[model samples]
Target chain A: MVKNKIKTVACLLLTLFFLGGCKKTFNQPQSNPEAVFNELWGFMDKHYPMFAIKEIDWDKTYAQYKNRVKPGMVDAELFSLLNQLLFTLKDGHVTLMSATDTATYLGFYKNYPLNFNLANIKNNYLFNDFKKAGPVMYKIVSNVAYIYYASFAQNISDAELDIFFNDIKATKGLIIDVRNNTGGNPANAEKFFSRLINQKTLVKYEVIKNGPGRNDFFEPKPFYISPNGQTYAKPIILLTNRLCFSTCNDFALYISLLPNAQIMGNPTGGGAGLPYNYILANGWKLQYSATYTLSPKMRNIENGIQPNRTINFEPQDENNGKDIILETAFNTLSLE
Target chain B: MIKYYSNKTVFLKIGLSLVCWLAVVNNACAQTLNPDLYKWTFTLGLGLNSNSVIDKNFSQLPYSGNGLGLSGSITYQGRLIQQQLNLTYGMATLQNKYYNSLYATYFTANYSPLFCLNNASNSAFKILAGPQIAMQYARRNYSGFVNNNSSFEFSTSLATSIEISYSIIPIGLVLKNKIAVPVFSYMQQPAFGFATFFANSGSQNSVKNSSDFLVPNKFYRIINNFTIDKQLAPRHKILLSYNLDFYKINTIREVKSIHNNLIVAYSYLL
Candidate 1:
């Protein structure tokens, strides 16, 4: 009985020591809320290099927020306030953080976009003697059209895109290239795909599994037909490379399921989810994947979407502007 | 009677000191080392550049220029089943004399399965695989009578990198050699919508034609180092180390290569 008592005492003491050490490691000096607010306000007032905005009273804004902060306020509350202040600057470069929020922030880059090559005439218009380089543009006999969209973020207006689509619709067949697209807003992709897809069809399903401040399970969201209506009834070929990612990959995977579409080129860049952002203390923002996606065949698309017919691009061909991948797509369309 | 009381008080003080010492010793002994379990590690490092020149001849464009740089990193490591995993965060900033600056920040999570070479020595190797989030910021200002244009271009790039690291040492002075390959790099053109600015001035888009913000057609690094550590007294250790790093930035067409920097760093690891 005496020995047992000694063992229990030893265990209790060890636990206490471990807990104390952990507390010391994580404990930071309590920040004086008033001092922090004053410092932030002063930095903005004195060092704001740009005198762009003259209307708002910086001092009043600082005074209002300074008094609202309390000593016991959690890190989340501080982070949210910092984010609000940063957003006021309208600079996309600035961000804030706490240690706990970094994981989500790191995760945002993982599933952000699909990879594709982009070709914008306007981009060329800005430069004289501009030659179309990169894998996104191809000219095959001028009869078959090739277009590489590196991202959906291009400034192509809806009307301008419609006209471009109409121009391509006259070709024998169209090669929609999304070789290195990393992804952007799904709405942008929907605008392009809506013109090709005839009937309402399910493209991809998404489920948010885990993330900061997220629920345990979320139902899958589906990609549906766009209201803009269909444009192309002819056979369409999609050229993809390992760089194809995110929404671009999803569009290819979903459209491949259609009987009228065929996917060629390399396997896609693997990003099959959505990332949600959370503001943290220290004005750092965290983003993480709040979801996972599966193709219609119930296969996880994170490893990448495999092409129906695989065609590899030689590095030498890419340098010489000899687009072997586009040639394959053109031949496939012509054969059809 | 007074002397006896003082002695008693002294004895009590000695007893309390003994108790505290025993508690510390007991806790250390109870902390078992589980080889199968995960361990967290933090690292800090400083780097010096060997070569700093942005070779623009590969693209047939004007020189982008280069500058000296400093870098640092912190990492956490663990084992999940047969796989060894590491999560690292790193940053570097470089400044050229011509008022051009480059900043890079990245976070990478990697996993590699332990391939036991010889069971007798317990030394194993693995190929790391995972994703890296990288952001590069570049800004340049051209002033003085030497240059005609004076402007600043800022590019925000989001890229994913695939990395592979080999653990040459496992126990005391663990060394890992890693190489990262950027697969997808998407950058917002800093010159986007600036065409109107140039159009108004009839400058003919000179800024957009400059290859200052071209995609780093290729970027990779190699790190070789040994970490030696021994406890000097209690929780303190005299950490001494040497590290060699190599960085190569390739051209967009993979036709010609330029911009190579090698660094050797000596640091006291805490």
Candidate 2:
């Protein structure tokens, strides 16, 4: 009986040990203004990657914002404080989403001149005679093929690429306009670049945030653009403006790499980092850039990729239904 | 000369030792065991399950949900050995405090062949111990983030399993408890970001980059099962069970998950 009792006790002890050994406690913060502020600041302090690049002292920012969060602060008040905190980052990809309001920072493009006019291009240039091919609108004028791709959100399949290239095969040069294209899937950018490169080209580098430290990052990896689908070898001009962001910024960087291509118009809106979402204790969501893309020379493209030739769109030209940027692209393509 | 031993070397040595020990024990206990008795049983189970996960690659907050689970197992019991194969699948809609929901699904399968110990004892206690091989595939779909919306984990583990049963003759009931702890595992999770920019050979490289052979120090898992069974007829039995599973992976980032299940099963003697 004593031996049996010993065995039972042993079993009970083993069970308890196993049950308690691997358990972990989750510390979700309390739903209060101060807690929410601390949580947001703490999360960003760990996960945000561009503190040094943006030249913001986060600890100092925390000090400035911490005392503002009161015990009885309303949600809107708290949201405004957080918005002010995020605004200092000067990132186009950052947004604070709540049930009632979505706070965004549009300084990358909103403060700049709106350089693109779609009505002028349709009426004055294409004369409303552009042909639609899948996700792109194209027109041929004076042996120059003009393709207007408004956004990368829509995919251009290989078959569609075949049709697009076949229709523009007879042209001497091409003008690919992506003005006001904020962003979309980067895969579409890759697909579009593949057709432009004749050989595999090491286009840029990419790095991810690996640690919580301000400077902790993985070694930069090479991003290559390989030749795929229909190849286009004619002189190519990529039009851009401050409204070109995210994948459009990537498009600008890619077009600059080709010997046969040049980027015209203003600098692209810089949103070079990949954005990710996080939730706070109060159920509000915060989205911020988690990974950053680097140029082939390992330079930061966060402030926007500058054009090969800067050409400002004259406001007077808009009154006459004339797009000077488009006119410049035509002149540049003709010179090529 | 200084020799450096890696985790892989330690795992191989320990695994070999366990295999040799099992062989010796099996041979030693063979003479005392009856070889004529054999039985086969098939079991189908329905359960209510709940799980919580914190995948740091996506978010640090715990997302939890409840769902129904289905499990099936086939057991072959002999005089000296018992082998079983079990499969389970579950689906859940996990939510956070912010009401953002993520749909999750997981499937698990394991096979274990245990050698019976204390079979000749008259103390109303029976014990079985052996090694188990288990595989789990789990995926989560969250639309809250672009490029990081979906993530999946595929892992295979080699675990040590132990089972103890106490039979009550007067009440015609059996109480059994089983525990399995993984000693070594091969886990495949997503990379730092769900997908890297222009990853060579496309997007699947994220899954390939995060695959690693890990020991218990890096990845820990435990499965605990308890059941009370009563025989309805000579060829039928009903069981009520509670199972708990927990696992944590400690890499650059941490991912922890816990599951609790309450199950009802019917066994058909075959």
Candidate 3:
């Protein structure tokens, strides 16, 4: 009886060993052109939070673009058709990426004046003698600190900021020029903002899509920045332009909440939505704004944030090897 | 040969040689080495793992790929009980139908105790049953998705385990098969479109909110291991093992993952 039981047990284990671990395969969406188009449209319809904000009738967009995507259409034709479909949103945050190329809307900053001239600033203001701390390029121009922050993508560590603030202790005021900063990591901007605030300050509000309904959204949640690193409480002028976008826009908005800071230059290139990405069945990636952001006054600041004072760049002044925006920031600091 | 030694001295040498030869023969044929003397063992393994995952929250298509990794274990083998602790880490890639790949990494630790059913018997076959506790953390990342590209899970499971081993005396080999099924688990999976803000929130509650206790119907896991052991010396062994793990979570968005591994290891008996 013991031998029989052992034989049975061995056979049962062998059977189980052979029978297990079958790979599961899920039905993939068809790789046809029309099917790809429908997948893209359906995802955007369900998850894209800015269709209502951008005043787009997605069903009408589907009606207009659906016929353009045929079953036998090639990849290039399908890509172009999808590009046209995405263009109606007029959002800088939206993009379509394939193996060969990436397509995005540049009208946010392209149609406006190129308010920033790097060569002019480099030649005259932030000359070769300027000092670098993290992503910040700084030099005292006429006793006022000129901090030319080109992009928010580069990190400014707390230690680097401490060194930067200590170096500029003798300066009368600071000019923070974020003219062409298209945006990078928001945490970097938050870290930079933390130096200007003494207490926890509510900077903006954000709402996310929770349901598939066109109007479905979570209540706007408050975003705050608290004190961190070395505090610089001196008069600071934040310069902006049409090219300042994403976290650059966020930086400008946060600086406006500080009593010692003033925003100069044109309205910001607004891209307030938090972008999210999805992959289509054909391996193409589609990114769109998935959340809405509001200014402190509960106003829609997606188009752009208005500056406290408007400053413009001058080509004539560029011919003289000077950036008029920097001069304007200097004059504003002098008044302070 | 020569009269160099007296007959008495020669006889003494001859008697001593005979006794030594007989002792050697008796020791060689005895086969009475006690395993209980060497109860503790340490094993180090190198393996390759192939995985297939279908996470509807991340994507509808299944991502399948393989990777190479290493594992280490410590085991105690008493006369009628065995216990082991195993730790493993591996990195792999999961590719969709369109050839897009997501980077996957995983770490696991498991502890099991088995009681021998027929340890007192002289039969070469043995059966053991016990419980296993396993904890695992896995994460998948894709660079293409800017904000919601990463997804991760942490699970602690209690499982029923059984092992069967048979010794082939002629070849001096032992073959063992073990299987386990998780009865219940505490698992955490993020909500749809796992937000980047929550990842940087630095709040423990955010992690707790995504966790829940799950039963068999909602969370199912199974593990099967087959191994061949050869005793190279009284204090050494070489093992070849194959292990399979299958896990699935049924929620608003269902996710299923399977791992197939083949390992070669060396065990040192102490």
Residue by residue across A224-311, what tens digits does model 3's lDDT show?
7788766788899888988898888888888988888888888999888777777787878888877767878887778888888887
Better of 2 and 3 by lDDT: 2
After TM-score superposition, the amount by which residue A205's alpha carbon in candidate 2 deviates from its true location, in angstroms, is 1.2
The TM-score values for the models, in the order shown, are 0.35, 0.86, 0.77
Ranking by DockQ: 2, 3, 1
Instruction: Look at candidate 1 and tell me the lDDT of residue A285.
Output: 33
Candidate 2 stretches with Cα past 4 Å from truth are: A1-28, B1-36, B76-83, B111-120, B129-135, B154-160, B183-186, B195-208, B211-220, B232-236, B268-270
Q: Write the per-residue lDDT of candidate 2 for residues A242-334, one digit (tens) a residue.
A: 989988898899899889988989999989887878777787888988778899988999999898888886778888898988998998777
Model 2: how far residue B165 lies from native, Å: 1.6
Candidate 2 lDDT score at position B140: 84
All candidates: CA RMSD in angstroms?
27.6, 4.8, 15.3
Task: Sort by lDDT, best first.
Answer: 2, 3, 1
i-RMSD of model 3 (Å, 1 decimal): 3.9
Worst 10 residues of 1 chain B by lDDT: B195-204
Sort by TM-score, top down from the best = 2, 3, 1
- Worst lDDT run of 10 residues, candidate 1 chain A, spans A21-30
